[model samples]
Target: MKLLVVGATGTLGRQIVRRALDEGHEVQCLVRSFQRGAFLREWGAQLLRGNLCAPQTLPPALEGVEAVIDAATARPTDAIDQVDWDGKVNLIKAAKAAGVNRYVFISILGAEKYPDVPLMNIKHCTEKFLAESGLDYTILKPCGFLQGLIGQYAIPILEKQGIWVMNGAAPIAYMNTQDIARFAIAALDNPDTVKRSFPLAGSRAWDSNEIIRLCERLTGQDARVSRMPLGLLRTVKKILTYFQWGWNVADRLAFTEVVVGSEAIIAPMDEVYETFHIDSGEITTVEEYLGEYFSRIMKKLRELDYDREKASKKKLPF
Candidate 1:
């Protein structure tokens, strides 16, 4: 399969490209800057310089592509209308013009339910455009990523011995980005996956308390768990917004609210496993992921210390 991956430089996009390459597919990445995407050349991906916000740059990227996986997203500095909605609409038009066979889109869970939210609203609008574009499509509505949670909360626990959680004991499942890549690839050829949408999640759900307990057990490190009120987060978001430095914090807070407040966002583990023929046991759990992550950091630090000691033992050139 000859595949074109938009947002190929992004976290999930890069994972999708890697998985596609491992499967022996020819991959091309549409990137805005060649310098940032120089590594893609080494990874065997053909780079097509383009920006999602600029529709004129897409036709060349879409040419000769059999399928497209759109993983592009709006950054904190970007408005949802320009990058998320209009950008995707442009890509869809180009893909259709190029006679692309399949279009795979990565969308967040609860998009339709959160129409008032800027980002979610844009995603919902893009999904609608793809559905009516008269092209074969697959929409993946995945839950919060495990890697994201680890980056946001796990490191704080390891370094500061504490983590903040909203809505005590509220459970949320975190999906792996690699699993999402697998599903996206599967959609390219699976007849059943065409024009179908999937709500994805991890094997199990964990609340803040469970997360802290698992971290302590895995790393053998004790950390304090602080429960935060939803109202407090809302207030903080308002303050940050007033200062015009709150987009990132506001996005996180909004997502946290969804995770803590909604039961519908949780994907049924058994249903996902059975329907997709996936074994949840094979997926990386939050505890396992954190253990490996912290171990790597410790190992790197030890290597750096050893290098410093070796340098100090050498005689000075003077």
Candidate 2:
């Protein structure tokens, strides 16, 4: 299969590209800048220079590609309409024009139910557009990405003090990007996944306290946690947005209110496992993931400390 992956530099996109290549597919990645895709080129993926917001840059990227996996998003609230909504619609049109067979889209888990939220509304609208675009489509509504949360929230806090939880007791399932990529690869070729919109989640759900305990067990260090009321968190996010901060305040608040405020974001895994013939045990556990991650961090810190000590010794006078 000849595959075109949009947003190939992103966390999930890189995983999907690597997985697709490992599966022996000819992969092409659409990137805004050639320099950004240097790693992709080294990994044997053909690179197409294009911007999703520019329709003229899309046709060449789509030509001769059998399928497309869209994982693109515009950061902050300002660019959602142009990049997330319009850009995707343009890509769908280009894919249709190029006679592309399958279009796979990555969307949020609860986007359909909360269309009023700005980011969710845009994604929901794009999902509708893809469904009606006269093309075979697979829309994957995945829960919170486990690696993403760890990188953004867990690692930084664990390195300093403790993890912060907006609602400590809320049930949330964190799915690994690797598993999502596997399912996406299956969707690209499997007829059973065609025209199907399904919720993807990890095998288990954990609250914030459980996550902290897992972190403690993995790092063998005291993992402190700070909890905040959900309503208070929302208020702070709103104020941050009002101040025009660079962070994606609107999207963050929506995620907090919708995903974090709700019970576990999950679906029956047996059917998907059976259909794709994937093993449930293959799904990564939070402990295994955090253990390896913090180990690397600790190793790097040790190296830095050793370098500093060597430098001090060099500066010492006998």
Candidate 3:
């Protein structure tokens, strides 16, 4: 089967690409930057240059592809609509025109109830569209990506003083990106997972403190877990909002709601395990994930430091 993976360079998308390739499927990745996807070319994936925001780039990417998997990331509010909702519509249309059959999407868990929340709302809308489109579809609503805990959050803490700062004591159901990719590839390959929204997650749940404790066990460091006050965090958020910079106030507000409204959003790991018939033991525990992640980041930092030291020695009063 010829499968086209959108956002193939992203965290979840990359894993999906690898898993699809491992399953012996011919893969094509729709990437915005040729330079960024150059590495994938060596991995035997046909790299097609395209942007999701640009509909003109869709037809060529969809041409001759039998299946589609979307792991695209989007901002909470309008951006989510723009990407997940609007961009998906474009892709569906193009896929229909190209005579493609299967479509698999990566969504967040609890999207069904939190249609008021920007992120979940957009996913819900997109999911609705996909279901109504008469296309063979499988939707995987995953929990907080374990990869984000490593790539997005933990790397910053490791660079700093081993401080993991979070908003509250909210519990999150997290899952490995590898598992997500595997599920997505399974949906693409098997006919059974179609027209269903599988809630994907790990074997357990953890709050910020518990996560920190596990991190400590992994790195053998008493990592300090700091909680930011809501009022103060909101004030800083509003200030950043005024500047309209990375993660603006609206984004912060939405995230604050997501974190504080955890009771409504959080799902049980057993739910996902039941749907996929996957053993909970097969999933990576928080400790296992942290150990592997920390080692990789340490290697990266060492290489970076070595390069800096060498460059510093070569500087001759330029």
Candidate 4:
């Protein structure tokens, strides 16, 4: 399979590229900057410079492409309306024109229910656009990414910085990007997955307090926790909505509804596991993921300290 992977520099996109290449498929990555995508080229993926915002830049990348895995999304500083809405609309049209067989779109867990939130509404609109575009497509709605938790929780705790959370943050079944990548590639080849939506999730759901305690246990460090009332986020969203410069921040803050919404943005993936022919046990749990991260980080810190001690001892008069 000759595949075009969007957002190849992202956590999930990079994993999908690696898996596709490892599985003996030719991979082409659509990247904005060659400098940013240099590592993907080193991994044996062909790079085509393209931007979703520019519809003309997309078709050339899709030439000779058998499948498309779109994991692209707007960055924090980016204009969400342009990238998520206009850009996605362009990509779907271009893919349909190119006669691409398999199209896999990575979407969030509860996009359809949140019309008030700009990002969610854009995603849901894009999902509808693709579904009605007369192209073979599969939409995977994945829960929170576990790899994201490292910076948001692990590093903050290790560095003794504030780990911020909503007062009553909901428990999320955060799936590993590597595992999500596996399922994405599986969907790309499976005919049954065409025009269907599947929930990609981890084995267990974990809350903020549980994760903080887990981090403390693994790193042997006390976490400086800061709690924000969800009500304040709603108020901030309302104020930021009036300002154009603050649109991105306001769009992000709109995601707070997930924490307070009735559905917890998680799903029982027993049917999904069976459909993809993946076993439930193969999914990485929160504990195993955190445990490995801390162990590796601790080892690196120890090696750095040992090197410094050895250098100091050499300079001393015994």
- The C-alpha lDDT values of all candidates are 0.82, 0.83, 0.76, 0.90
Q: Please provide, for model 2 over 101-156, each residue's C-alpha lDDT reduced to its tens digit, 9 standing for 90 to 100.
A: 99999998878778667788888899899989999999988877888757545675
List model 4 lDDT by residue over 43-65, tens digit each.
99999999999999999999989
Which parts of model 4 have CA positions greater than 4 angstroms off?
259-263, 315-318
Model 1 per-residue lDDT tens digits across residues 33-93: 8899888878999999998888899888888899999999977677667888889999999
Give all TM-scores, in the order shown: 0.87, 0.88, 0.83, 0.96
RMSD of 4: 1.5
| Candidate 1 ranges with C-alpha deviation above 4 Å | 224-226, 238-253, 262-264, 269-277, 295-318
How does candidate 1 score on lDDT?
A: 0.82
TM-score of 3: 0.83
Q: Which pairs of residues have clashing backbones in candidate 1?
A: none
**Worst ten-residue run, lDDT, model 1?**
262-271
Rank ordering of all candidates by lDDT, starting from the highest: 4, 2, 1, 3
Clashes of 4: 0
lDDT score, candidate 2: 0.83
**Residue 107 lDDT, candidate 4, scale 0-100:** 91
